[model samples]
Target: MVLIRRMLAFLMLASLSASVPAFAHKDHDRKQHAAEAMHNSAHQEGAPAASRMHQEPMHGAMEMEHSADEPPLTFTDRLLSWIGRLHPIIVHFPLAFFPAALFTATIGRRRASFATPVQFLVVAGGALAPLSALLGWLDAIGMDPDPLLTVHRWLGTMIGALGAALAVWAWRKPDQDRSGLMMAALTVLTAAIVVQGWFGGALVHGVDHMNW
Candidate 1:
């Protein structure tokens, strides 16, 4: 009976010893899986931040390249600006000079003694008319193309023609009584020039339709 009991106790101890290795393997597998899962979670959490950091420098580089590709403002820009500044003053001279010449011519013809001064003013005003017209045309060309430019151009041509005609008449008149008639015509032409000048001024300063 004692011998049988010892053999049964040994068999029970052997079975318990065999199960210990399986429990240890299962615990090791669980720890390995938990460690792998923690590593994967950390990587996933950092991915977005890493992507943004990579993209930020690329975005900054692209912006820098775009700015570098742009052209700089040039000397033509400054020249045009100066032309625009002088435009109004150049245009106004003919407006004043033409009318003054006509007035002086009228007074001179009435008195018959002041014709020389009137003739001189007429020639001077006529010479200035074409110059003013040229400058005005240049200024118009610098601006954006518009329908108003057509009107301004035609008016300038008409004024130039009338000024030239008046200058010739004043120069050629031979102390004749017909000087009064020529002066009267000049007065009427000057009136028309004044109206045209006003229209040009409105185009520039009134609606702000022009570009420098």
Candidate 2:
């Protein structure tokens, strides 16, 4: 249990240190892109109105052509893109851990000796949950906004938070018996995971992912 807690603490620190700068840099890039877009819009507005109207189609085509001719991604960019693609793979860890914790805890309620294992699962889940969420955000940072994506992102975030909370609850009361409140929280976490999993699948497989 001590080892699990230490690992989680380490992960928290690493995530903070790594994410802050990466996100800051991404934000800077976004602001720069937005400013450039706005400047181009302003330039178009300053053009003769009739000419602007006549040139709109050509302007869009030219932008597309320019994008097509843009240089390929640099090595670093390609590596980052490959890393971003790992989100789906990494997400399975927490997806299994939280539910597995709930299951272990449920069984542990009957057998007192299962407490240690329950604690282990909770801490493991908590540690990986945030990492999964971070990877998801990085992967989707440049994706087109959509309702399903929005729901999946926020719900996945909420589940990660809940996983962390569950770990803390278990750590603080390591030997304490599971109370009604803890059971209820576990139930809610499980349900949230189910819903979040649906949304995640829908994001990848379309809304009919669970049509059956």
Candidate 3:
């Protein structure tokens, strides 16, 4: 049963992460519109010589701004961007692990043998959650900021903190959670994951992401 559960969880994670690209596709249109607007604004009604004079300095300033926006295409920038891209990939692990841990912890409350697996999942999930959050921060560097993005950022950070704390709590009180504190914490962790997922989806797919 445990093996089957683990296999199913892996499959779910794989499917979820694989669909991230599709969710992000809408952003491309928004980006294109913004680019077009910038281009159009750069050309304004005026005398030809006056417009050229105005554009020259503006063009130079825009170049400088673009350079500041993204680091030079050096090895370090490339490597960080590559790792940052892995945010989409790595995020699924904790998404799977914490929920699995919640399940195991709940079941393990009655069956003590299941505690070990819960601990394992919690520790693994807890560690990776922060790494995933860090990668997300790096990846968001050039992203357009919005309310959804702000909420996702803070919520993701909290999830990482809660996951890590849950791991430590489970470790420190390996056999004394009969009061169901760990179970409750795990439940809250799972809830946070769900809410964070929605915010993330909304950021990529817009406010109507869940509209049927």
**For every candidate, C-alpha RMSD to the true structure in Å:** 37.1, 19.2, 12.1
lDDT of 1 by residue, 1-212 (tens): 99999999999999899999989999999999999998997788788878889999999999999989988657886676567567567656667766776677655656766666666777766776776776666666547767667877878877877777766766776464236576676777687786676677668586453435
* Model 1 residue pairs with clashes: none
Model 3 weakest 10-residue run by lDDT:
40-49
Which stretch of 10 consecutive residues in model 2 shows the poorest summed lDDT? Answer: 174-183
C-alpha local distance difference test of each model: 0.72, 0.83, 0.84
Query: What value does the lDDT take at residue 130 in candidate 2?
Result: 80
How far is 10's C-alpha from truth in model 3 (Å)?
A: 38
Order of quality (TM-score): 3, 2, 1
Cα-based lDDT at residue 141, candidate 1: 57
State which candidate has the highest lDDT.
3
**Global Cα lDDT for candidate 3:** 0.84
Ranking by lDDT: 3, 2, 1
